[model samples]
Target: MESSVFFENSEKKKKAIGIIHRVYLSQLKNSRKYLASTKTKSEIRGGGRKPWKQKGTGRARAGSIRSPLFVGGGVIFGPKPRLVYKKINKKERKLATISALFLKEKQLVLVNENEFLNFDQIETKLICQLLSKFELEEQKKILFILPKPNKKFWLSSRNLKNVEVTTVTCLNLKQLLKASHIILSKESFDLIKLTYGQQ
Candidate 1:
């Protein structure tokens, strides 16, 4: 799609770099699952019995087998499940998304929505042919923005490792930044302009 007039201001372009970086980092941080967990000494099982007598054993005074120093022991300061969140202002996020779109304008392709409709049968080759027509067959990552979900289109594109399909409402900063090429249906492009361009 053509670059939006909203992004034409040189001053805005200059400031977009910092905003985009901040939003990208915020989205990345917020997406983390943070599910790593390690057992502490008290939490470890089978540590109830002392390894040996404290003084009589030839080896050094013994404690529970689950001591951190032991072979199969509890971790001292291992990672625990926790949340990491970074919040960005609504306006800032919108600006960052717009900036990302502006940066990727050259890689953007606008297609009529009808071209993706009336699939007689689901086929991966059809999607491949569509990409070939756009000269994006070799592109590593392509993002498809649809006005709404299309099961046939989604199914046809799912097998491709490098293609992603998302609606305008579900679009996010990370996806926008990571995509090497973005394909937008005419309706989807208009929706994005309506949502992110007025400001």
Candidate 2:
């Protein structure tokens, strides 16, 4: 395969990496989700009856067992289960992704598909040894973008620290920015262009 196959991009050179930070946080915020929930006042038990008469008890007017002041009472205005995802435009997503591609310097490495085929079998140790050949074993953060999701490849790299494997379709701005070093499978390189370069 040609070395230029991985780096060919009409806009890569003109694109500024710094531009991505503008929308990075927004994209990240929208992507994350949490299963948060809280109980309402009425949901609390034992609030059925009044604790005392309304008038002259002189005890500051006690209510039911489920009052906010009570030990086991429901929380007041606590977090509720609601979606917090922010909407991002397709153009913005494309811009952010392209910016990440442009940001890569010497840290980006491309692996030809033939190299993977040379492996007798896929294994964690085998993948590590392969990376050592590139002197990449010590890299603190590495991301591998496969052209397509390969279960064997994912399993092979899953156990390695500072290593993550994802397919082209799953690529996002967050993963692209998180890694210090990026490895693009030959197919992934082409797919990125096809998916994001036309516009």
Candidate 3:
């Protein structure tokens, strides 16, 4: 089958294919970098004064309550939150997104345009039935992309553990690449073409 609309014209997709690993690893590293760490010594409370006399006790030299050797002591060499944002060139970011999009093209499922011109009304039963019809019921992870925010559809799919709903404008590489199946509303498909293909 032919490649998706975004990949139809330029060598952008080819460029993306060449640097997939660099982009993906950059993403993976950045994802873990920003998360706050729990065991920092400063965050731990109460390491005030020396516990006992230093020499008379004949035990390990007593130190402040925060000594690492003590029971309630502060952590030693624990992790702390640090800057983790990786900067990729704008063109590279776009290329990586397009690359991921093209890679996932075969798994893309575009809603039938004839069934519903505007799928504004979110009905759980109807959505579930559609899932069955599309043979997506068994998929472990599915992403629902809409042209814009639809409170109704988002609420409807909120209960499905394996499904997520988002608009084309807010598409993120992490979320896009993580899903096993991508169900794009007709409007979303059009928006994606306009947004990425134009570049």
Top-scoring candidate (TM-score): 1
For model 1, residues 1-199, the per-residue Cα lDDT tens digits are 4354656777877789889998888888898899999999889888899988888667987679989889888999999999988878988988888778878888789888876675557898988988898888645899988888788889998899999989887788888888999998778878887888655
TM-score rank, highest first?
1, 2, 3
Give per-residue CA lDDT, model 3, range 1-199, as digits (tens). Answer: 2466656755856666766667777878887745556554356676556778789777888667666776766677766668877777767776676677778887888886543334467677766876898888645788888776778778777878888888887887877788888887667777776775545
Cα lDDT over the full model 2? 0.73
Checking candidate 2 for backbone clashes, the offending pairs are none
Candidate 2 to truth, TM? 0.79
lDDT of 2 by residue, 128-179 (tens): 8768977885457888887766777778887888898887778878888888
lDDT of each prediction vs. the true structure?
A: 0.83, 0.73, 0.72
Give the candidate number with the greatest lDDT. Answer: 1
Cα RMSDs of all predictions?
3.1, 4.3, 4.4
Candidate 2 C-alpha error for residue 168, in Å? 1.6
Instruction: Give the 10-residue window scoring lowest on summed lDDT in candidate 1.
Output: 1-10
